[model samples]
Target: MERSHDGYDLFSPEFRADPNAHWAAMRQAGCPVAHSDKWGGSFMPVAYDDIRDIARDGARFSSRAIEVAGPLEAAGGLYLPPLTSDPPEHKPHRGVLMPYFLPARIAEFEPFVREKARKLAEELAERGGGDVVTDFAQHLTIAVLTKMLGVPPGEQFTDWMIRMIRVGPKDQAVRAEAIHEILGYLGGLLDEREVEPRDDLISYLAAADIEGEPLSRKHKIGAAFLVLIAGADTTWSAISASLWHLALHEEDRKRLVADPSLLDTTSEEFLRVYAPVSVARLATQDVELHGRSVAAGERVLLAFGAANRDPEVFEEPDKIMIDRKRNRHLTFGSGEHRCLGSNLARLELRITLEEWLRVMPDFRLVDPDGVTWSGGQTRGPERVDFEVVR
Candidate 1:
């Protein structure tokens, strides 16, 4: 099979393990727009400025069409809410969803989030060691999202979400089956909510009126799935990558421990260094960028991982500075399509790291070589084993 125009093979273990080298090579080659037949019509942007420009100007580079072109679109079909829509239409959907994730509402979730993190940490501490990615990061995200969605904390929701959002080759049939199961469950939950509307996000959406009419069943389900998947998988990836970095760089970990005030800045550095999701957007109109001409309707991948490491933007782009000031990384993306749950993600990450460092200050990766990397839209360590050293 021919590799993508940018010479990236998505399935290649090397690419999965480390994409920075390939990104650097492409940027050196003059920020060219490279095509990939594998992704149907997607192109990779190699320069930092080009990606930032494209992301900021949604008029020319729309997110609507791109949401349908890639694997995510194929998986769940064309019913994604805000993540797959553009401005005028995007506004109301975002409006309906935003309140549930508002800073104040998220504050309400902090105690619950912290307790869950502490509980997970306690379990890991009991084991004295565990695969942080699978045991801790994955389950912590699942618990948080399920609780937020008003689903009873249980293995069913967690297992289903983990499987449903797992990135692989696009399988329309399997995806459709999963979607049907999820919607069926959500429909029943909505019915129950209607009978007795609770304060949960689903109930809020159920009662939300758009243009004077309540959100339809489809909108409810779509919005719920969008929030659930985004909230669960992406946050887990970010948390996992942050832990992985700390495990590898003991000195940086020590620095963070010395000055816990560095948590927020350290989180940003982690997002820059380990951008979990390599999100893509479709160009709605033809535009020339960084000497490369991209055609209208072509897929433009905003390589956040690459952009974060661009030499023109950040000095020592490869190094993870715990107290990195002047850092304006686009890991949460930019413009109207920026992540609504970013505040929540940051909160969760802060709590997770703070609690972990406090509980197991000297923990270390048990078998670094045994760790594996996973890829798709998001990238991170698949299995990271660690031991508590207290």
Candidate 2:
């Protein structure tokens, strides 16, 4: 039952409005490798097993071409070290930075995460209503990153982060420009650390010993750049999406408002339902996947959102189960290339949802018809409008 359509258009208004529906259609059509040139010829695997296997099997499916094009190649495009690099090289690079994102390490930052969320939540409460994405998610995203990465909350840095996250890689030139700006910003911080060390990510990366030597300036910039872009972008979608879910589902929101402890379960449920990222990988060699011949060098988009919804893996996959059992959806990815900052992401989401409910528990989306999602790579409401009475 191949799709009657030629291929999936990621940027199609229909797809952008509802990727889940697109994925469902693709899956139903029994098409696993739907290639599209919309973003420079990429193949998307819409099944749970295929996505999981491709992500973990880095040897066969190289992450060196994470995107269909070389938009951000200078900073380390597809070969974004650690993430873009395959094993042996990947392990050491990822290992050097693992200590910083360890569960215990991220857990220690709960107070900072909560305080940031609380402040933004209180302000939103005081205002009596506003765009959750702008008023709440954006501020908290920047705040958490600034504190965690040890970057100063400077206006320029904040502005860059917001722009990079909000306006991510729509055009090649703009994306390349954003990469340069991030490198320049982080490069300056690195130079400062060289003269006078500080207890921050830049300082650590510039000074830390990897494989008995400090990471080269280039590697430092690459690792830092990955974090800067990844940190500022992904989790905010999850945060806004959580609120979006609660906004529409009163039963779910009321349950959480009644007992905030359900946050851990509820957060996971929201993450599963609205997984934010759909990272791509380049095939290392010719391979057969789901009856299709995938030639080497082709980009494979791992539809994380689609994988989470596969009925094969989840019972009643479409509905929200706040307390889903044995839940192991790949929201943070899988294997060695799994998201480095997942622990922090979870904490941000949990704390953000908590603060939102505490302050604006009864908030609802002003108009479902007016909602629209941002579509290049990550997905979430571009502007989550809430009906709040000031």
Candidate 3:
């Protein structure tokens, strides 16, 4: 209703708690592009068309600096390959990592993913109740990512990863220290892979070539950093949010449980309604859109979650129609930076839901009001405590 400086403050507790409500207010006020002075000033585009155009125009909107709250360069100075790379450099670097995420490669990882998810589900059932965020979603995602990256397989390694991503955005000193510590750990892993190559991502990167030239040491570490930072938070948020949704809606839960085949569309619907990621881009040149002027170098925040809910694109934007026939949402984003791990992310979400429903069929939130959420960039319930219906 009321705005500070005639713009939204993304870091405020209210916005983080319920961003959708804020977006609705902005839409009703007919503001397609809202300006905010927070984080060195950022412009948010809520409509689907605006977001799509900005994403496609790589020339105008540079992906070099993606951080909105603060800046933490990957591997000290080197850009995180593909994720932060732009244009020609982006293509070659992204191409190198493409093989690992291809459908065939992802299918190879399915057995491992399913086994981990199934075990977590059974453990949750045995306990009768647990915090799904920490106990289930975080554990499963960390295990898979560590195995893929050829790092030590344990939750201990995840503390820094979580802190670096979740807390680092809002705090500068913490982010710097976390980045330094992560680089040290990854550097050691890379050194080990160099001497004794193994059949893992680290070893592959050690010998992998970008175009004709071999990747530099900095390049190797930056690529690994991307997997560590991007891969874990985004997927787990999706998984945790999906479970949170099912825990609240009994009818949707029962329908999905009755006919598991609906998982395909249901997963898409969940992603659309609860899109977890919001990326940043730097405007290379001054531009005018929706009667607002964006100066060069100003950050444009792409709220994919808001774009997905635009009334113009979907018939009923607010309501989650699980069986919606024609659904086209930008949960994984669009254009060049569209998530590289989409296939892996989809596989993990589907299997997590399948195993969860199979083992813990009837469950509900232990305390809906107590379900707290994490803010900034990626948003998801921090704790989703639930118990069996029986």
The RMSD (Cα, Å) of candidate 1 is 2.8
lDDT by residue (tens digit), candidate 1, 1-390: 122346456547887788887777666665456666564557777667777787778688777643322453342244668887777788888888888878998899899889988988888888898888778887888878877888876666555554554532344455556667878888898889988988687888788888898888888888888887787767888898899888888998898899999999998888888887766677777877655667876677887888889888999998888888978887888778788999989998999999888877778888877777766567778788899887
lDDT of 2 by residue, 300-350 (tens): 889798899999999999988887765789988888899998888998998
> lDDT per model, in order?
0.77, 0.78, 0.85
The lDDT-based order of candidates, best leading, equals: 3, 2, 1
TM-scores, all models, native as reference = 0.92, 0.94, 0.96
Clashing pairs in 1: none
lDDT of 3 by residue, 338-378 (tens): 88898989999999989999999899999998887777778
For residue 338, what is the lDDT in candidate 2? 93
- Order candidates by TM-score, high to low: 3, 2, 1
List residue ranges in candidate 1 displaced over 4 A. Answer: 1-5, 65-76, 290-293
- Highest lDDT, which number? 3
Which one wins by TM-score: 2 or 3? Answer: 3
lDDT of 3: 0.85
